[model samples]
Target: MCALSSQVRPARSVPGARARPETAHATRALILATFAFTACFYAWSIIGPLSPTLQKHLQLSEFQTAAMVAVPVLLGSILRVPLGILADIYGGRRVFSALMAFSIVPVAALAVWHDALATVIALGLLLGVAGASFAVGVVFVNGWYPPERRGFALGVYGMGMGGTVLAALTAPRIAKPLGLQAPFIVAAGVLVVATVIFASMARDAAKPAPRTGRVSLVAPLAIFRTSARAWALTLFYFLSFGGFVAMFLYLPKLLVGVYGLSKIDAGSRAAGFALLAVLGRPVGGLLADRLDPKHVLRVSFIATGVLAVLLGFSYKHMVPLTAECLTLGVVLGLGTGAVFKLVAQWFPDQVGAVTGVVGAAGGLGGFFPPLVMAMVKSATGSYTIGFLLLAAVAAVALSVVSRVRGDAR
Candidate 1:
């Protein structure tokens, strides 16, 4: 009990209290953490890019193919909660190193033993461990920055989303020449190198965060159930980050259906869409530092709602559709950065637990919209209703932002 109790830190009665990071290591910490996160994210989402190849090799049914892609997303998304909790208690350095070390096993397994549907699905569940790195990296980066600057630092860290872009670009190109297992081989090598670099260099923020309240593994769940602020933030991220992820995964299919573009062209554009969001994070963080995060949230939600509405009407038009999609990408990235800015501002002392809950919300949030879009498209033969539903959700979240704090916007 004593050893177990030592690993899990208690909660703070006061939120947003922590010493400044050791400046000497701050730059080094940010760089190494982002690098490690990039490799982890590559492992997390690489299956999406490799799915078609896997489907051909395994002769998988459509349902089976979809399941293989989705299992990792589901497991990786839900795992953020406990992983974040672990990062806080055990420290990001140990937790991150361990997570990647374990991830290498599944990556290596999939490279060689991926013939049967059951075997692939089981290994994919293990690979989801890589996606949990976000919560860990956030807590890790949060430890290194003061409350005011976390918006920017974490935003820079969020650039790790480029891992998806990298996977999209690299998986097919490399697999065409080298065979199906080659991409997994390369990803495993990257993780191995990243694990070594991170374990050697990363440090948590200065120790012993003020702990006036007792906490446990389930503390985040309790707060998630009880706290309206956490819920509000969760909803906002659900819309913003969730929307970003949904679009990342679904845009190619959307383009092919609506514009009748070739698969290669649609995929290239989807990669570009992801790039826009990747670039937007740091900008969003900078805006959060300069302006109030509330302002950032308001602009992001309002703009996102408006753009989504525009997209619904213009889905068949190539130019306007592209413009709206591109703008939506940047706005969503800003909302993601601003949400964490609020976390640092309001719940700094509980960064990891709170982040776990919020990050899990973001992850789970991505699941519904693609489902909605597909269902609405199937039933009505138009995606307008699905998008309008998304806009309605955004407006509701904007209202939550108005009431979440003391002021109305």
Candidate 2:
């Protein structure tokens, strides 16, 4: 069990306090937290865009490169469980700033010692700290918004994932002028600036209940055991958010290898995918808010499955491939938003711990696909099998969604 501080603040129900002022405070907190998340995601995913360059320089096999790109994601996924709990106990502002500050060291180290494989891998694991920021930010942002507005607010925060797009578009170009190490150096600087701004500007929401005793470490597990819906959400996110992560990290490699495109062009296309997905997230949230989340999810999963099948056929024409990729981006992005809306709806009281567990599942979802893609590509000498697998998973998720009974609202 994790012991919480005995000190508890009163809820904002004072006679003179008004809703307008509280709304303003919540908006400010959301903005700062979203920007902070952007910085963290940029640092967390920096390695993906650099993987092709690193592979060429180090003569790494496909499996080795996939492993290198995946290390941080694995840590990021597992650490979210604890970090989310800490945010729930200590408050998001403090925990989030501390995480950003801690990440600077490893981001800087990766810049200085990127040539050594072992050192790069070690630093990448430490870089996973930045990835854990998502759980913290989710908990933080969820606390500030009312139930009706949470979906949209969380969707906006999810846009910070555009940081991955930023990395994809900029890292290679930055590496060209300043060298391969420059990207990490710049990412560390961004974190430093974000940490200062967030700590200074962000405020935690008032707690609804006073802390009377220690929070059990096993509480999250207990919640998972009791709530079949939580498990369903976990599986759904594993496909949606996980697929998004896998695509972001693996797309550059795929583009470069399959299309014979230059690294710069590949990165640009990958950035497009990231951008479309990032933009689609908020739309998903808005739809979930207005419609049944299950309906939104059904549309998204079906679209994703259909698109994955079309992509599996391996269209060689640039126009068709680009169209398919962009369409998938929209579906996956919407699915990501819809899944979290469900989380916020179903587990409002345990947002922090629930976010941690579900987010971890999403991260783990992202982790395995690259290895599978790499292995399948290695064995079959094509990415067709990988696309087929994505379609299969989407179908399975759709089936699960159909079985679950609940009011989306």
Candidate 3:
């Protein structure tokens, strides 16, 4: 196994040393990438909050609604592999611009054809590309920060995840005034502006682009097959980021069904959940940088497992349910930050390729739980089974983490 021990950072440049220009450039890239990521994610997030309204309008069954909501997540997630590789090869500025430009098509289609489920499903597939922007940002940001500061830098870049908070908070309210089309129109506009600004301003870090004479997409995927560390990170992200996405996307539906909250109320509450996670991500990164990330993982997984079981039982009471959900958000957010820190540490040379594999798993992590929840609901008349299943998975992850060696306690 690759050493999990923390290595010392390279010595800081002397005050008289010429690092200012380089630092400025890295900051510029980091800022722009974070903004563009937030915008792209807003488009990715639109469907989840709106799925209930669409369900009511179309008279669809619960399972169908869940599937509809998950389809974009599934596609967005699966595409991260290639997108990350593309960012690594062609540069993040170019790949991110193209991604945002393409996403506008689907967002605009949703605006014009808001009432048609077929149109939404078809266009939704295209819009999912926006979700792949996470990979692009990870590869881009990793290029800028040195290993010593990368954990915190990535956690800051990760603040872009708050885009889901923006969606959960706003999509429902926007739909209230201007109809279902309004939110999509707004998202399209956001993508347009982000694309223009990022294209004009963004630059890849000074790292040399990987010069594969002929890029074979399949070849990059070999990381997952060959690297034990990559698989471990992939599994952790599947739970951490996956759990976060699943809750952000599905909490509105859950609250509405179990507690009888209005769509707007549930949406606002879910926004709170996402917001806490957003805030916690950086904290996790900071902690990981200070302590061994393996220990951070251990604490996050243990706490997350406990919280998941609590959420399963607490649904009947809003106080405990909301508390558990919110706490779970912070824990999962930390897990996410710490996992990527380990990725950056472990695969310094191949962050993009490794991230593609890990990110796809994270996306799939978000995708499956909704389906599982839907199935559980269909058969058992409650979502408890899904939460308990998550707890069990958390336990499994903890066991994997416990074996991590070389890192000092």
TM-score of 2: 0.93
**Which residues of candidate 1, in runs, are more than 4 Å off?**
1-17, 52-67, 115-117, 207-215, 256-264, 406-409
Please state the error at residue 287 of candidate 3 in Å: 1.0
- Tens digits of per-residue lDDT, candidate 2, 123-223, equal 99999989999999987887767677778889999999999999999999999888988999999999999999998767776543355788665676668
Candidate 3 residue-wise lDDT, 110-160, digit = tens: 888867677777888778899999998997787767787888888988889
Which portions of model 2 miss their true places by more than 4 Å?
Answer: 1-22, 207-215, 407-409
TM-score of each: 0.88, 0.93, 0.93
Best by lDDT: 2
C-alpha lDDT score of every prediction, in listed order: 0.79, 0.86, 0.84
Compared to the true structure, candidate 3 yields what TM-score?
0.93
Ranking by TM-score: 2, 3, 1
Off by over 4 Å in 3: 1-22, 207-212, 405-409
| 1 versus 3: better lDDT goes to | 3
